[model samples]
Target: MLYIGVDLGTSSVKLLLMDESGDIKSIVTREYPLYFPQPGWSEQNPEDWFSALTDGIKELTKDCDKTTVDGISFSGQMHGMVILDEEDKVIRPAILWNDGRTQAECDYLNNEIGRDKISAYTGNMALTGFTAPKLLWVKKHEPENFAKIKKVMLPKDYAAYCLSGVHCTDVSDASGMLLLDVKNKCWSKEMLDIIGLKEEQLAKVYESYEVVGTLKKDIAKELGLPESVKVIAGGGDQAVAAVGTGTVGEGMCNVSLGTSGVVFIASKEYAEVDQNALHVFAHADGKYHFMGVMLSAAASNKWWQDEIIGTKEYKKEEAAITKLGDNNVYFLPYLMGERTPHNNPNARGTFIGMTMDTTRADMTQAMLEGVAFALRDSFEITKKLGVNIDRIRINGGGAKSPLWCKIIADVLNVKVDKINSAEGPAFGAAILAAVGCGKYASVEEAAGKLIKVIETTEQDPVIVAKYNKKYDIFKDLYPTLKTMFDRIAE
Candidate 1:
């Protein structure tokens, strides 16, 4: 049998087709426009996602046997606010995960309500990107829209509803909403009351690999697929990406350097809040994982190469940056504010320690090293919890850069393994569909058979020592500039 995985991303929708044995048959992508009506705010129409998925599926399965398709699943951008009326029409353009319009609501949750209580109820602290804060933003500013809301769903869950005629979400995806009791794997009534929502407005929660419903007959007919095809409850992009990298069993680690950078570490049993800095969320493999995120990763490189240097030749520019950690110039990678360690919305990107002697190569190296140091901040918190990780499987666009991968390896002092297939969340979603369809017995089993490492980048002790001294200095710049960032923003 065949399975389909839909990766609903911020910029595009990517679809993948796979056989029962985990071999990919074909992959397709459809791009969509992103709207920015104001500074620091991002929005997208959810209807575009459904249309792209339907069209991409048709293109992906055109030459293949569509009748053999057995199941479908999704890995989606998390924390977007998607609402529906009584007739299930989209109420407004979705507030994207990167939207920073929720600073007031976040301050209300973290300071007025208190982070301790919010963490106690939701198992995570409030950020500007979480669904709870987005909900508050809508209620305070768009009162008319809030009054008409009949249901609130995440981005990919909206597409699943259109395909399967079910309103549901998985625990891994719900963990980012700030409305779930993540430690307990259920919705928190306290959070619901705080957001002025009842249980009826929320979708039913399910495990990531469970079957949600069969595909709607109309949808199947339009795509030339079987009506009996099952739609499984999948996960958020990060969780599913972990599965694709084979980071499923206890103590496994996966590092992703996409638009955002993340470090994922799996645990055999549920762990309570530790440090409360890193996210403690349920994993798609029916266990638990701790994750740390950097708001800008590969995006830092993109901004420098395209917007600043005026070039699309990333490889040519990076080829000039030979020096790793000895550059005098330094860049604080806060282009999108920051998340993991800082959690400061007022923070802005900065360049410190530049001189007349500094070259473009020196500044470029700083951009790469800056992102590495930020990720190391999160790794320190995980170490405080007594979690030890020796090596991590790396994925995403940044992972394709040899210099960046080497910098991450030496800075973190962990070996970085490059996988043969780095298709991101779309491939991961397809693997989840295969598991749900009983093509494989368990998630671990599926990953063990599918995820393959093609090469490993080992950390050099000499380079590691150089970055270690530089990281200590990088950690101090944020606190010193915190007030300045706020004052300038005001």
Candidate 2:
């Protein structure tokens, strides 16, 4: 039997067909528009995601045997607020996960609501992107629309609903919403009370690999697929991407270097407020995971390459950056503010230490090294929590750069494994689909069999020591600039 994994991303929806043995049959992508009505707000239409998924599925399964497809699942963008009315029509454009319009709401949650009680209920403090804050934003600003919400769901759950006609979400995806009781694996009643939301307004929760429902007959027929295809409860992009990179069970680590960077650490047992710096969320494998987020990662590289240098030849520019540790220039990668340790939405990206003799390569290298140092911030938090992760599987656009990979391995001082597949969340969703269909027994068993590390990047002690000193300086820059960033924003 074949399985379909749909990666519902911020910019596009990617669908891939894979056999039970983990060989990919076909992959296709459909891009959609992102809207920014205000400076800090971001939104997208749910209808766009549904259109893209259905059209992409038809293309993904065009040459394959559609009848043999046994299951469908999703790896979704997390924490987006998608609401539906009683008749199931989208109330408004979804408030995207990257939208930063909820700073006021976040302040209320962390201050008025009290971070301790919030953390006690959800195992996390509020950030501007969380769903609870978004709901508060809607309720305070758009009371008419807020009262009309019959259901609230994440981005991928929206896709799953389109396929199976069931309102459901998995634990891993729900963990980011600030509405889930992470330790208990259920919705937090206290949080629901605070938000003035009913439990029935939320989708039914399921484990990541469990079957939510089968495809609706109309949806199956439109996509030329079988109606009997099972819809598996997949996970958030980060959790499912960890499964794709084979980062599961205790002490396993994975770092994503996409538009936003994340340091993901898995644990079989949940920790009750180990530290407030990193987010504690339920993993897709019926366990828990810790994540430290950076709002900008390779995005910093893209801005420097495209907006500054005016070129799409990333490798060509990277070829000039030969040095690893020593650079006079430094970059602060808070282009979209920051999360994790310093949950400040007022932070801004800055460049310091440039001199008359500074070269373009030095500036570029500083941008790359700055991101590495920021990621190290999260790694330090995990270390403080006593999670001993000596190696991490690397994925996303930045992992393609050997120079950047070497920098990351050296700066973090860990073994970096480059997996065989670069499919990321798409492949992990497929693995979940396989497990849900009973092609494999559990998520870990299927991941162990299908995912392999083809190459590994080792750290150099010499560079590690240099980065340690540089990182010390890097950490101090953010604190010094905090007041200035706030004044500038004001």
Candidate 3:
């Protein structure tokens, strides 16, 4: 039987067709517009997502026997607020995960309500990107819209509801919402009350590999598929991407260098780190994982290459960056503020130590090294927690750059393994669908059988030493500039 994985991303929806054996039959991507209504605010029309997915799915399965498709699942951008009215209409544009309009709400949650209590309930502190804060922002700023809300869903859950006619979300995605009692795997009543929400307003939560429902009759007919096709409860982008890269078992790590960079380490049990610095969320594999996310990773590189350098030749631009750790130029990758270790939304990107001698190559090298160093900042916290991860599977667009991969390996002083397939969340969603259909016994079993490393980048000891020195300097820049960032924001 075949399975379809829909990766509902911030930029596009990518549909993947895979057989039970894990071979990818076809892949199609459809891009949609991302709206920026104001500075630091990001929104999207949820309808655009569904439209893209339907079109992409038709293209994805055009050459195949559609009747053979047994199941569908999703991997989606986490923490976007998609509220629906009583009539099941979207109340407003979705407030995205990258949106930074919830600072005041986050401050109220962390300071007024208390971070300790929030952390205890959700296994994470309130952040500008979290759904709870976004909900508060809506209630305070858009009371009329809040009054009309009957259901709250994440971006992909909205799509699942459209397809299966079931309002549901999985544990992994719900974990990022700050509405789930993550340690207990249920909605937090205290959090709900605090946000002036009721439990019924939230979607039913399920495990990532559990079946939510079958396709709705109209959707089935529209897609030319069977109504019997199971819709598996999928996961958040990072968690499902972990499955895609085989980061399921205890202590296994996967580093994603997508728009945002993350250090995801799967753990057998729940373990919340100090100050709730790392997100301790339920994993798709029915386990737990610690995640450290930076608001901008490959995005910093994109900004530099596209907006600054005025070119799309990423490879050619990166080719000029030869001296990895020896450059004096330093960049702080806070293009979208930051998260993880430092949850400062006021933070801004900075370039320091740039002299007249600093070439475009030197600044470009700084941007790449800066992202690696930020990831290392998260790794440092994980190490302090005694999670000894010596290697990590790397994925996402930035990972495609061999030079950037080597820099990450050297900067983190760990071996980086490149998988044969870089499909990330879409592939992981298919694996979840297969597991939901009983094609695999468990997520781990499916991942171990299908995901394979094609190449490994080992850290050079000499380069590691050079990066260690540079990273020390890089780490200090953020703290030193924190006050300035806050002042500038004011």
Task: Kindly state the number of residue pairs that clash in model 1.
Answer: 0
Give the per-residue Cα lDDT of candidate 1 at 24: 88
Candidate 3 local Cα displacement, residue 54, angstroms: 3.0
Please identify model 2 stretches exceeding 4 Å from their true place.
272-275, 309-323, 353-359
Task: Measure candidate 1: CA RMSD.
Answer: 2.4
lDDT of 3 at 93: 100
Q: Once model 3 is optimally superposed onto the true structure by TM-score, how far is the C-alpha of residue 343 displaced, in angstroms?
A: 1.9
- lDDT of candidate 1 over 289-308, digit per residue (tens): 99998889989989998999
Task: Using lDDT, rank the candidates from best to worst.
Answer: 3, 2, 1
TM-score of each: 0.92, 0.93, 0.91
- Total clashing pairs in model 3: 0
The candidate that wins on TM-score is 2
Error of 3 at 259 (Å): 3.4
Compared with the true structure, all predictions reach lDDT values of 0.90, 0.92, 0.93
